[model samples]
Target: MAYKKLSEQVQELSNPQRSDLFVKQFREAVREGKFDATFLTERFTMPKTFSRRGAEGTYQRDTRDMLFDVTPDFEAWFEETNEALAQTRRTGNVKPTAENIAAGLVDFKALAEETRRKMQASYEKGQALGKGRSRTSSGGGASKTRSRKK
Candidate 1:
C-alpha cells in the first residue's frame, strides 16, 4: 500500500530525485521523531574524531563485563565470582561455593579461561572496528596502525 501510494505520488512529481527525497523525508518524519528547535533538544553522540591536539583517550568496551547478559558460561563464572567475593573478609580472594567447584565454573581455572575468552572477543571486536573502512569518500582513510605495539 505504501509503495503503491509512493509510486502514484512519484508519478505526479516532476523530479526523479524528488521521489526518493520524498520517501526519505516521510521515513525520517516517522523515525527521526520530533525535536525541539530550542536549546532543550539534545542528544548524546559518540565523538567522531580525535581532539584538536591529536590526544588519544582510552575507552574500555567491556563486552563481557558484569556477565549478566552474556552466555551461560559467563553467567556461571559471574555467579562464582560473586560467591567467592562473598566469602572474602576484605583480605585476599576467597574460594567459591561447592556447587560452583563441582560444576567447574568461576574457580581459578574457570575464571582464567572465561577471562581469556572475553579478552579474545574484545580484541577481535576492537580490531574490526579500528580497521573498518569508510563508506563515504569524505570519511577518513584506512588506518594501518596495529593497536598493540610490536
Candidate 2:
C-alpha cells in the first residue's frame, strides 16, 4: 500500500468526525504550554543621507503590534465549518448549499473583525499605560564618547 503524503494526511484531520478531536488535542497542548506564540515586530530605518536634505545620520525604529490569542475562536469556527460542510455533503448535495456557505463566511468574518478590534484596543491601552513611564537608553544607538584619565 502506498503511504499518503504529509499534506494528504494533514487534510484528513479536517474530516468532520475528527475535527472535534483535533481541536480538543490542540487546545490541551496549548494549555500545557507546548506551543509558543511569537509577537511580530517591524523595524524601520531613517536614511543617513537624504537626496535633498543631505546627511542627517541613520537610525532604526522598532514598532510592536498587539498580541491576542484567537486560537479558541478559530478552533471553534473550524469545527463548526467542517460540520456544516460534512452535513452538506451527506445530504447528497453536489455543491454546498447557500446557507452552509453563508453561515461559515459570516461566522469567520465576524471572528476576524472581532479579533482585530480587540487587538487594536489592547495595543492602544498598552500605549496609554506606557506613556507614563520614561524610556531609558538601552545602548544600541550610535557610539558614545569616552573620557581619558590623566
Candidate 3:
C-alpha cells in the first residue's frame, strides 16, 4: 500500500490527536490480522533527508533517522544522559556531550528487521488459522452446494 510522505508522517506523529488516531488505526489493523512487515517498514522507516544539529554545530542524522520508536534501551540511555547533564549543570564535574546519547540510541536497522520477522510470522499464523484468505482452492472451479427453496 502507498504510505504517506515521510514529512507528513512525522508531522502526524508530532501532533497529539493525529498520533492517537494513527496508533488506533495501527492497533486495529494488527488486531484484524491485516498488518505485515511491508506495512511496518513503510510506516516506520524515516527518510534519508532528516537530520538534527548538535550543540557544537555538528550535524547528526544518520543514526537518529534509524530509530522508529523510543525503545526501552533508548529510554534508559535518555535517563542516564539527563542525569549526566543535570550533574554537569549542578557541579560542573563533567562536560555535557551527545556521545553518550548517540551510543545509547537504538539501532533502527536491527529493530526494523526483528519487527518485520515477528510481524511476518504472526501474519502467516493468522492466515493459516483461516483469519486470512487461503492460497489454495477450497474445492474446484464451480460451486458444489445446491440452492435452497424459499
Candidate 4:
C-alpha cells in the first residue's frame, strides 16, 4: 500500500530535488515508525534500469579489448604467481598442512568457549538478580506497606 506509493516516488526521481525529498521522507518515516522493512527496502532499492543490469558491469567493447591485452602475458603472470606462492607458503595465512589448521582451530575454539562461558555467567547473574526483584515486587502486588513511627 504505502510501500508501493513510496517505491514509485523513489523510482520516478527525475531530479536532485525529488531524490533529496525521498531520502528525507524515508529517514523521517523510519524514525516515526511509519514504514517497516518492506517499505524501507522498496524505498532503498536501485532503479529498474540499474536493477535489471546484473551488478553493474559494462556492456561495451572495452571488456573485449582488455581481455585480448591480458591474454598474451597470462601464462607468464600465472607462473610468477605460483612461484611467489611457493616462496611465501611457510609464512602465508592459509597453510596446506592439516596439523597447522588443527592447531589454529583448537586455539580459536578454546578462546571462543572461554568467552562464551564468561558471557553466560554474566547473563545468568543478571537474570538471578532480576528474578529476586520480581519476587519481592510480586509479594506486595497491588498492596501498600505500613510505616512505623516513634
lDDT values for all models: 0.42, 0.47, 0.43, 0.45
Q: Evaluated with TM-score, which candidate comes out highest?
A: 4
TM-score, model 4 to reference: 0.24
Candidate 2: where are CA atoms >4 Å away?
1-106, 135-150
Tens-digit lDDT track for model 3 on 89-148? 233433224563356555556666888999999999987878434544563557779899
User: lDDT order of candidates, best first?
Assistant: 2, 4, 3, 1
Per residue, candidate 1 scores C-alpha lDDT tens digits across 1-150 of: 111222333334333323334334434433453211111122222212223456577432111101012344433543444344345444554467677677665476776788899999999998877666434534775886869877
The weakest ten consecutive residues by lDDT in model 1 span 60-69
Judging by TM-score, tell me the better candidate of 1 and 4. Answer: 4
Task: Please give the range of 10 consecutive residues that has the lowest summed lDDT in model 4.
Answer: 60-69
Number of colliding residue pairs in model 1:
0
1-150: candidate 4 lDDT, tens digit per residue: 222344343444444223333445455544674434333222233332212345755321110000112232433533443344335423445543567656773465665688899999999999999999999988857748777897
Model 3: what TM-score? 0.20
Regions of model 4 farther than 4 Å from truth = 1-106, 140-150
Give TM-scores for every candidate, taking all chains together and pairing residue i with residue i.
0.21, 0.21, 0.20, 0.24
Residue pairs with backbone atoms closer than 3 Å in model 3 (clashes) = none
